[model samples]
Target chain A: MNTLFVKAPAITLRFVLLLLISTVAMVADHRYRVLEMPRGWLLTVMQPIQFVADWPAQRWHGWTEVVAARSHLLQENKALLEINQQLATEHQQFAKLQAENRRLNELLQSIATSSLPTRYRLARIVQVSLDPHTLQVQINLGSQADVFLGQPVISSAGVFGQVVHLSRYSAQVLLITDSSHALPVIDQRSGQRAIARGDGPSGLLRLPFLAAHADIREGDLLLSSGLGKVFPAGYPVATVRSVSTPVGEKFAEVVAVPVADPGKVQEVLLLWPDRAVQTIEEPVTDDLVDDQADDGDHE
Target chain B: MNDVANWRDGWLILTTLLAALIIDSMVLPQFLGSFRPDVLAVIVIYWSLMAPQRVGVGVAWVAGLLVDVSSSGLIGLHAMVLSMQAYITLMLYQQIRMLPRFQQTLFVLILMVLGKLLAMAVLGMTGRLPTIEFWFSLPASVVFWPLIYALVQRWRKRALLPS
Candidate 1:
C-alpha cells in the first residue's frame, strides 16, 4: 500500500499534466486561429532548411541543363523555329479577325471589357511529389505577390493547379492530378457537362458518372466549365484518352491526359483577373461570337 | 570524472537531438517526410536508455512540444505522443539496453511507427490529416535507425573515453 501510494502520485501527476496540455492545445487549435501566427513564424524559421533541402535537386537540375549537347539544342531550336513560323502565320490571321470582331461588337452595342493587366511572376519549383498517391508541388512564390489561397495556376501549355497554401515566400499547389482535386470540365465536342477528377500516380484524370451514351470520344478536347468560378472558363483542361464501360454500368469510365506538361514545366502563370474586367467583358460569350464571325468572314 | 563525462554526454545528446529536429522538419522531402526517421523520438529514446536519470518524461514532453510547434500539426499532438513514448521507453529501458543493436533499432523503429500512426489516427479523427506524404516518411525513418545508432554510439564513446 505504501509503495503503490508512492508510485501512483507520480503517474497521476504526469497523466494529469499531459491531459491538461492536450486539452489546452486541442481547444486552442480548434477555437482560435492564434496558432496560425506562430505556425507561420515557424515556417519562416524553417525556410532556410527548405532551401538547403532543395539544394541537391536544384544542383541536379542545373547539371542536366548544362550537360545538354549543342546538337540537341540546335535540333530543338530548329523545331521551335518551324513551329513559331506556323504560329506566327496563325497569329496574323487571328489578329485580323479579332480587329473585325471588335468593330462588329461595337456596332452591336456589346460591352467592351478592358483586358486585365496580367503580371507574370516567375517561380521555381522547389519540391515535386513523386508519390503516385498525392500530386502536389511546392513553389517559391511567397505572399508578397498577393498570391492568395485558391489562385488558379497554369503552365504555358494549360492549367496546372491552384495555390492552396501560401507562406511569405513559398506556396504549395494542389496539382490537377491529385485524387482529392476535382475540376468542372466540359466536352468540347458535345458540350456535355462532367467533373474531371485526378487519379493519382497514373497522371490521368477520370470523368466519373459520365452517362454511358454520353457523346464523349477519344481525342475530344476538354475545357474548364468554370462552374466553380475558381478557374476562368475556356482554359484547356485535358484531352479525352479513353471511354469505357462495364456491362450494366450507367456511367462510362472516361479517362483523360492533362494538357499541361506536369513533369517538365518549372514556371507557371498565376491568373489574377481584375474585378472590373470580369464584371464587364464576359470572355466566353465574346470569344464565341468572335470565333463564329471569323469563320463566316473566312468563308 | 563520471560527472564530467555525463555533462559532456548531455551536451552531445542535446545537440544531436536539436539537429535531428531541425533536419527532420527542414531538409527531408515531404514525400519521404512522414517516415523521416523520428529524429527527435530516436534522440529522446537513446538519451532515456543511456541516461534515464538525466532525461525523463519531462524532457520528452518539452522536446515533443517543440516538435509539435514546428511540425505544423495540431499543437501538443507531438508533445503528448513524445512524452508517452519517452515514458514507455523509460519503463522498458532495462530490456532495451540488453538487446543487440539491430534488435534495439527494430524496437525503436516500431516505437517510431507507432508514434506516427497514432498521431495520424488522431489527426484523422479530428479531420485534419494534412497529406498522404505524412505516412511516406516512416520507411525512410526506419531505414535511418541503424545509421543514427552507429553515429550516436561512436560520438558517445569518443566523448566518454579519456582525452
Candidate 2:
C-alpha cells in the first residue's frame, strides 16, 4: 500500500508518455499513411490469436454438417443441382450475348469494356470487426494468396465490399454498408446515376445528392456504374427501399437496403480485373483473348 | 525469491490478457455486436487496481494497440483511450478498492461510459460519428464486471500466493 502511494508520480509519468506515443501513432496512421507496412507486419503477428478465436465456430459448423440427417443433405443437394442447371443455361446465353456485344463495339470503334477479363477467388469470413463504429470483416485470404488493397469482393447475390487491409494470411474488407463507404450506382430501370452512401448502423444507404425530381423510385434496382473502376459494372449493389421528396428541399431523401446481407455471408469472392493492356505493342488476337476470358470466368 | 514471485505475476497477467484479446476478436452474432462488453478494458481495469505494480499504463497501451491492429482500426485510437482509463484507475485504485462492491460497480459503469465517450470524441474528430448503439456496451460491461472481478480474484489468489 505504501509503495502504491509512492508510485503515483510514476503512473502519471507513464500515462503521459504513453498518451504522447499514441497520439503520434494515430496521426501517422490516419493522416500520413506511413504506418501501413508496420500495421501489416503487426497483423501477421496477431494472426494466431484471430485464428484461435475463429476455430470454435468453424468446427461447430463442420460438426453440425457431419451429424446432419441424410434426408436433409439429400434435399439440399437436389435443390443445388437444380440451381446449377439453371445457371449453366443462363451462362450459355450470356456467352453468346457477350460475343455479339464485343463485335458491335468493334464495329463502332469504342474502347472495349474493361480490356481485360476479371478473375475471382473464394474466401471465407474468419472474423467480424469488434468495433461497432466500423463494419468490416476479416477473410481467410491474404497477401499470401495475392489479395491486394482496393480489390473488389462480392457475394453470390450482389456486390459485398472491397479489401482494405492485408496481412500474410488474412485481409480486412470494408463492407459496402459501412458509413464511410460510398459507391457510384446507377438505377437499372431509369439509367440515372447517383451516389449511394452507407447509413452506418441502420444497414441502409442514402442518396443525399440526388435532386428531388430525379427519376429514382422505390423498388428500383441499383447496380455498380463502373465509374469508380474499383467495382466492375453491372453488379447488383442495392434495391431502393424508399424515396421521399420533402417539400421545398433541394435533395430527395432516398434510402436503400443492401442486396448483400453481411450477417448471412459465410463466403465471399475476391475479384482481380486485369488492367495492364496499354503497354503491349503486339496486337493480341480476339479468339485468343476470348479464350482467356472464358478461363477467367471458370473460377 | 522476489524475482520468482515477480515472474509468476507476469505469467498470470499475460495469460489472462491473451484470453481477453481472443475473446475481443471472436466473431459474434450481428445483434450481439453492440452489446459485446469491452473484455480487455474490464481486464485491464481489474488488474491495474489489484496489481498496480505489474499492470500499469504501459501494459494498457500495448493491449490497446493489439486491439487496434486486430480490429484493423485507426492504430492508436484504443491505445490512447485505454491508457487514459488505466491512468484514472491507477490514480484512484486505493479509494476504489475501499468502496463497497455495489459502489465499485457503479464507479466502473461511470468509467466505462466516459471511456466510450472519449472514443466517440476521437472518432468524431476523424469525421466519422458512431451510432447510438455504441453506448450499449456500457450496460453490458456493468453486467459482466462482477463475474470478471471474481474470476480475476480467483486467479490472483491461486497464482500470487507463496505455496
Candidate 3:
C-alpha cells in the first residue's frame, strides 16, 4: 500500500467540498451574476491563451490569401466594383429621400423615432464557443474598444448577433441563432411587427408568437423593428422560408433563414447607435451618403 | 522529488494542460464540431490516474474552472463534472492500471460518457439540453485516448526519469 496517496475518506471529503463550492459558483454566475467581475479578470488572463490558440488558424488564412489566384482576385474585385457603383447610384436617390423625410418629420415635430446615423468598428472573430449547444462567439474587441453589453453585431450581409459578455480584450457574442436569442423584427412588405426567436444550431429563426391569421407569408423580408433599442431599424435580418398553420393550432409555425451565414462570416462590424442627435453631424447633401458608405467600407 | 525535478514536473504538467486548453478552444469544421472530444477532461483523467497525489480532485476542479471560463458556460458546470470524474479516477486508478490497453480505452470511454451525461444534465437544468448528436463525442474521445496516453507516457518517462 502506498502511504503517499491521500486517504479515501479524505478524497471523498474533498470531492464533496469542491462540489458544493462549484454549485454555489454556478448559481452565482447564472442567477445573480456575482462572478462577472472575477470572470472578466480571468478572461483577461486568458487572452494570451486565446491568442496562441488562434495563431495557427490566422496564419492559415493569411497563407490562403497570399496564395489566392490572380484571376480569382480580379474577378472578386470586378464584382465588388460593380456592386459599389450600383450602391452609389442608389445612394443619390436615397440621400434626397432622407432629406425630404427629415424635413417632413421636422414639420410634423415627430423626429424622435427615426433610425439615426450609426458608427461602426470592424472586429475579427477570435474564438467560437466550444460547446455545441451554445451559439456564442468571442470577437477580438471588448471594453478596451468601448464595446458594451448588448451592442449590435452585423456582417455585410445582415444582422449577426450582439455582445453579451465583456472582458478587457475580448467579448462574447450571442449569435442570433442561439435558442435563447430573440429579436424584434418588422415585415418590410406588410409592416407587421413580430418577434423572431432562434432555433439553436439549425441556423433558423422561429416566429412562434405570431397568430394563425397574421399577414405573414413565405419570402417576406424581416428587418429590425428597433423596438428594443438593441438593433437599428431598417437593417435586414431574415427572410421567411416556410409558414404552416395547423387547423387547430392558435399560432402559425413560421421559420425564417437568417441573411447572415454565421458559418462563413470571418469579420463582423460592431455598431454604435448615435443616441443623441445633438447636431446633425453633416449637412444634407449628395456627398453625405457617399461619405458614410466610404467610411463603412474602410472598416 | 527534489526541488529541481519538482519544478520541471510542474512545467511539464502545465504545458500539457495548456495544450489541452488550446485544442479545446480551436474551432472545428461545422460537421466535426459536434464530434470534438472533451480534450481537457481526457487530460485531467490521465493525470489523475498517473499522478494521483499531484493531480487529484483539486487540480481537476481548477482545470474545469478554466474550461468553464474559456467555453463561457455557466461558471461552475465543467468544474463540477471534472472534479467528480477525477475523484472516481483516483479511486479506480490502481485497479484500472492493471488492465490491458484495450480495456483501458473502454474504461476511458465509459468515464468520458459519464462526464458527457453529467454535462448534458447541467445544460438541461438551464433548459438548453442538446440534441442526440451530442453523444457523437464519445467515439471521438475513445479514438483519441490511446494517442494521448502514448504521448503523455513518453513525455513523463523523459521528464521525470530518476537520477
Candidate 4:
C-alpha cells in the first residue's frame, strides 16, 4: 500500500490510438506522399530551431578555421585556386567541343543535340542524418528555392546525390552512397555503361550487372550516363576501384569509389534538368539514313 | 506549491528534451555517420519517468515527431516509439520512480533497446534494415543515460529551488 496507483488507463488508450495513427501515417506517407504539404509546413516551422541547434557547432567550426595556421591555409588556398583555373579552362574546351557536336549533328539531320549545363541552385547542409542505411543530409534550400524532387545534387568535387524530399524551407539530399541509390554510369576509358549501386556498409558502389567480358578495368573513370534523366550527363561520378570476375562466373563484379569527399563538404549545388531539351543517353545505334539519301541524290 | 513544482518540472523537461534532440541530430556525424547514441529517445524515457504527469503521452508524441522531422525521415515514425515510452512510464511511474538511480538506468537501458527494436521494425517496414552501426547504438544509449540523467537531475533541482 506504499505506492499510489491512480487510475489513468486513458494514457494507454491514447498511446494505442497515437500508435495506430502514426503507423498509418507512415504507410500513407511512404506510399502516396500524402503528408508532403504538412511535412513541408512543419519543416518551415522547424527550420529556425534547426539553425539554432546547428549554430554552436557551426560557429565553433568557423572559429577554428579563422584561428588556423595562416601558412597552411594559404598553401591550401593557393592550390585550390590553381585547380579552379585549370578546371575552368578545361570546361571552356568542353563547351566548344559540345557546340561543334551540335553543329555537326544538325548538318546530318540527326536528333542528337548536346545537352547543356543543367540549371543549378546552391544549398548549405543544415543537418546530417545519423542512420547509416539512410545517408541523408538536410540542406537549407527547398521549395522556396525551387528545389524539386529528383533534382541532382553536386559539389565541386563530383556528384553528391539527388534531392529525395522537398520541404518549404529545406530539403533532404540522399547521398549516392546510400544503399538504395543507383545511377547509370559509363566507363570513360572503355565506354561501357553499367548500373552502380551503393554497397551498404562498404561505402563504395557496386556495379553488379556488367558482363564477364565487359571492358571495365582498374582505375577507369565513370561518368554519369544521364540515362535516368535525373543526373545530368558528363559529370564525374566515381572511379573504378577493382574488377573481379570469378573464373566460372557469368558476370563481372566491379566496384568504384565516389569522387566526392563526403567528410568535408558543407554545401551542395542542386541541378535541375531543363525540360525543353531533354537529351537521351543511349549509344548512337540508329542507321545513317541521311547519308544514304545524300548519296542517292548525288548519284 | 504542487502546481508550481509541476510547472517547473515541465519547463526542465522541455529544455532537456530540446538539448537532447540537438545533440542527437547534430554533432553525431562522423565520416559515415552511424552508431551515435539515441539521445532523444533516452531523454524521452528519462523525462517520462521523472515527470510522467507533465511529460505524458502527448508530449512524448510531439517529441518523437520532432526527431522524425529533424532527421528528415518518414514522418510519425519516432512519434509511435515516443508515445509508447511515455505511456509505459505513465502506467508504471509510481513503481519506477521509487527505484534507485542505478536500477532506473538499467530500466532505461532496456527501454532504449526496445525503442531501438521498434525503430528497426518501423525502418524495416518502410525501407532497408539498419546496419550494425544502428544496433551498436543501443549500448551507447545505455552508457549515455547516466550522464544525461545527472545533468537533467541537477537542472530540475535548480529549477525547483525556492526563488
- Indicate whether candidate 1 or candidate 3 has the larger DockQ: 3
Error of 1 at B63 (Å): 7.4
Q: Candidate 2, residues B1-163: lDDT per residue as tens digits? A: 5566667778878988999999888877768877898899998998888888778889999999989988988889999888888889989999999999999899888889888888888888766777787787788788888999898777666665767
Name model 1 segments beyond 4 Å from true. A1-39, A80-89, A93-117, A128-133, A276-299, B1-41, B48-84, B98-103, B119-143, B159-163
Measured against the true chain A, the candidates' chain A TM-scores are: 0.73, 0.87, 0.86, 0.83
* Superposed model 2: Cα runs more than 4 Å off: A1-6, A276-299, B98-103, B160-163
Tens digits of per-residue lDDT, candidate 2, A127-167, equal 54556667788899898987776778899989898877788
The lowest-lDDT stretch of 10 consecutive residues in candidate 1 chain B is B25-34
> Which pairs clash (backbone N, Cα, C closer than 3 Å) in model 4?
none
Error of 3 at B71 (Å): 1.6
CA shift at A216, candidate 2, in angstroms? 3.2
* DockQ, all candidates in order: 0.28, 0.66, 0.67, 0.52
True contacts kept of each: 0.22, 0.75, 0.70, 0.61
List residue ranges in candidate 3 displaced over 4 A: A1-3, A127-129, A276-299, B1-3
Q: Rank the candidates by lDDT, best first.
A: 3, 2, 4, 1
Give all candidate RMSDs, comma-separated: 8.9, 6.9, 7.3, 8.5
- On a 0 to 1 DockQ scale, where is model 1? 0.28
Ranking by DockQ: 3, 2, 4, 1
Against the unseen true structure, what C-alpha lDDT does each candidate score?
0.69, 0.81, 0.82, 0.75
